[model samples]
Target: MLAMSSNPDSPRVLICDDDAEIREGLVQVFERAGFTAYAAPDVAAMERTLAAKGADLIVMDLMMPGEDGLSATKRLSGKGAPPIIMLSALGDDADRIVGLEIGADDYLAKPCNPRELVARARAVLRRGKDADQPAKSDSVRFAGFRLDVARRELHDPDGVVMPLSAGEFRLLRAFVERPQRVLSREQLLDYAFDNDSEVFDRAVDVQVSRLRKKLERPGIEVIRTVRGEGYLFAVKPTS
Candidate 1:
């Protein structure tokens, strides 16, 4: 049996790929796995479908005919965007890093195992829902930024909301929860991902890099690399 999310309802997923066979196959795979799956031929169709009926997550192909997956990924990941799992034929570290950098919650090389894909989808959806659940009125403040833990929101000093993926939110949570403490790659992974997800050390590095780009500013080094030790959250947060 496929893994299920904590919510009883099956999550909705949209697969955007140019290949008809591949798209249809993935749609069947997700449906059999108990997801409400939809298929789109390209970014345009994906946008149209989403406009009509939003999905909980997206499974996008990296190399499409019109607006490649990277661009679409960037456009789709923002303050209200659904989680995305990118599928790419190019199975290089650089390619995966780019996808992660652009806010894809997960990355799977093309021709991936359907079972693994289902597992990844479940993991991402679970994390996203967890992040959205509001806790008590608790917020963390540091370096002119505010992290509303309950609402899973990060806001700039100007009160503008910044977009964050589930993985990014977890990493930042680990940092803010333990300011000035250096956490090893293993520890960061432990904090950021559930046991069901198989993420490597290099993947952690890519996530930190992307998080830095989002939070870093002049004289505001939120996260610092501790050379061989690991990474340290430089700013001290106040509750």
Candidate 2:
């Protein structure tokens, strides 16, 4: 079942949870916060709502009777899908990391403050809106690699396309845009993630490591780590 609001101009948020009370409560909260909110009882209904109405963001339960949130989020991971925030009873750091690595834009434990969830949603929406602004170029070239800004794709010098996760794409884009400059973890986080995201410096390091592996060559070092500082994009990029 789906309940929707009439405000077409407001941001659209889809809340999916098996618990009736939780779903309805979130719907009310988002609506009161000036969003055109929709509610779905399960993953199936969530998909239907997304296909029919579209959404600026998705707030999904980590556990459900049929398709779980992790599986569904992995399935939906891509360039154009709406950002997702996973709500789970498992509040451990490992669980949150798993959710993020699987493609959720953010994760929150259940029984959280509704206001915090709303704030996180707004932060994610702001990041999405910023990304949608027109770029000086559709593609950027650096160190025998090409990043397709519009499509969020990366290509090696050999012209083979390298697959990147959403986080990896954002991290790489940040690096390529500011080549030859040392960027602290905080700075990278500001460039690559929502300002209010709970991601830590370790998450930034992990993303940089993953991007480094993809950009690695036999003897060519593209990203250089400065001792006691941060990482630097060793080459200049041209758009």
Candidate 3:
């Protein structure tokens, strides 16, 4: 459930689109919906705005005059930037798949319904809000992957502590605390990031894979697929 703003303030949205008309229209739509919106017509402005301050969400266009949204999305993935909803003229599944692959949380075709856009925004944010929570502790060590919340770190038998991005830490923590529970993608996103994204379940899978690689246990047995279900932390955790 979305919470009422403490002071009736609006969310801050950053809009990056080469199309001036589209950018302005989205700004108007979000503003009318009680969001403070900022627009950037190109990638350069997008960078500046993103670096200047964090935003609640970023609305970006796929095709641009300069570097495309796909490339920008890659950079955002590396930096773990704000949750994004991409606007693309391309309606192909491959394009959408690529967007998801690179970490664009949501993808919307151009000329979408304003009402739907707002709903998407809220839904994404609702997920984001769920991330603020930390899962209950059950103490897990699978193969060689170990998560210790008191220290906020994961370690191998070699004592090498892998660095965790905030999101990675939370996701891994959730699994460690609930080993063997086949948590759904939506559940993991909410667990790891405070319920803030419409991020694809695949993104969660990718993050888990990345964590698994870092842990590097035999057969990569830490995280296992349950098919039809989401994923499970394979080892039974202890106190």
Candidate 4:
């Protein structure tokens, strides 16, 4: 425990980076912004910190001396894992894809503006909140596949809950919230990612494929690809 603050109102965020300067700088930024920031040098220390003090989010550097951030992300992707913002010099398109593919909630290039970093962190938290949310919905049920908004779970006829990534959950939730409506990838990205930045349609397609595997049940065509239009969730809801 790094001396808990008496003010219990602030959310705690864990910062893991190999660079001392980067660690201290981020700590200062977070604390100045009304957050409790814990710094660690590696994933081992991060694990220790998480064990002692739970975090609302994690800001991690990708290239550490020992186990890299990617390894850490994969390990931490279990159920109810906290949101993560990966920082790295590898800001190439491929690197971002890999980071997102392996459960990272967001990515930021190093030497980034601190304000942008803070904004991205908040955005990630929002996305996390959105994923775990159970908003009022029509309770869509199609061909034995069930989406329960109140439960925030996808269920098969066997009554087994399906695992969904934060991204996958948001995408499906957007569709289930408004069934039989054709949504282009851009619109889906706007709601699911909550980003104004234009996202390629292939990204949505990939997420749909992943979601389909999770919703693998009989007689359900939850996501239908429409030629020259977009994808639609063709199902009526049930109680």
Candidate 5:
């Protein structure tokens, strides 16, 4: 089932939850916050709504009947996918890290304050908008590789395109932008994710590790870990 509110000028948000009351309540909350909100009973209905009427953001629940939110989120990971804020009863640090690693932009535990959710949505949307703005340079080159900021693509020295997840891309971009400098996990979180995001330092480590694997080559270290400090991008980037 899908319920929609009409507001052509407002940002569109799709709320996908199994609980009817929670779904409708979210729709109303987003509506009051100036979003053109839509409610979907599950991931399938959410997909239907997305195909029929594109959304700016998606509020997804972790547990559902057919497809769980984590699986759906992993399927939705890619360029142009709408930002997702995951809601789950499993509120442990491990669960949140898994959600983020899979692709959710933000994770909120169940029974969260409606106002806080709205605030987080606005912050995520703002980050998206900021990312859409024109960069001073179209791309940056580092360690014989090129990062196309606008296209969100990375090409190796051989011109082969390497696949990067949303989190990996952001973390890489932050490193390249501030190459040759040791950046603390806290700083990386601010640069790579929403400043208010509840992501832990461990999540940053995980993303950095994944990024290092992609940028890996024999005998060349691009990112380095500084004991008792943080990580540093070993090479300087050229615009």
Candidate 6:
């Protein structure tokens, strides 16, 4: 049976999954973890619920009947919506990278431990709330790619917007801010995650690889790995 929590102070979480059993199971987990959880069977229901009552976080499944998670995630991201954690039955680096590129805050493979999901939810919520604060203007432009720190957005040379997850944006920001500097993994994590993110070192590598792919273009190589050192933003970015 699906369980709902009635705590006003609890964060509101909306889970969108096609499987009834999985939906109910996640709802029970979230409720047990002190969140006011709601479940939707698909994207349509998820949208309706969000339109009626806003959500603090969204747990979305990757595969759905009509609109897949990537499409829904892109739509939500374009609107600057709430944080989202994508769950997928396919546990692969490519899937996780794609989810993040579409603006998911986190990605977890299905059959995930409920406790770990709770921890990720808490961490993502913490970062989301922190990001909601106003900040100073900071932007870096190089090779036609612009990193807008204030907006946490990336714009291509053609002025097209490229969606980036929180971690991806932050990592790129760290690089552009310190162009031509070789930063170790520890330094990168400190700058990007602020030591508060749940991501680890190998995950940092994955994010870098993904960001590099986005920033790469003809005759322009933005990032380079130093064998024993770390990574360097090879170009001199302009503010």
Per TM-score, the best of the predicted structures is 5
Error of 3 at 144 (Å): 4.5
Candidate order by TM-score, decreasing, is 5, 2, 1, 4, 6, 3
lDDT of 2 by residue, 1-239 (tens): 68878999999999999999898889899999999999999999999999999999999899998999999998886646788999999998888878887778888998999999999999888877676555678899888888888877788999988877667777787787788989988888889895445887766776788789889988889999998789999988888
Off by over 4 Å in 1: 1-8, 135-137, 195-198
TM-scores of the candidates are 0.88, 0.89, 0.72, 0.86, 0.93, 0.75
Q: Is candidate 1 or candidate 5 better by TM-score?
A: 5
lDDT of 6 by residue, 146-221 (tens): 7776787789999998877676766776787677989998898777765644445666787899889988899877
The C-alpha lDDT values of all candidates are 0.83, 0.85, 0.70, 0.76, 0.87, 0.81
List, residue by residue over 107-153, the lDDT tens digit for candidate 5. Answer: 99988999999999998888777766556677999889999988888
Error of 4 at 109 (Å): 1.6
Of the candidates numbered 2 and 4, which has the greater lDDT value? 2
Score candidate 2 by TM-score against the native. Answer: 0.89
Off by over 4 Å in 6: 1-9, 74-79, 92-98, 132-146, 156-161, 186-190, 193-206, 213-220, 236-239
Clashes of each: 0, 0, 13, 0, 0, 0
Backbone clash pairs in model 5 (N, Cα, C under 3 Å; residues 3+ apart or in different chains), count = 0
Q: What's the lDDT for candidate 4?
A: 0.76
In model 1, state the lDDT of residue 7.
31
Error of 2 at 178 (Å): 1.1
Among these predictions, the greatest lDDT belongs to 5
How much does candidate 1 score in TM-score? 0.88
Candidate 3 lDDT by residue in tens digits, 1-239: 01122223678788888877777888888888888788888878887876875578888888898898888877775354677788888866666666765666677877789888888777667655654344454344656556666555666777677666445666777787677788988888777644544455666777777766776666557778788888888777664
Determine the backbone clash count of candidate 2: 0
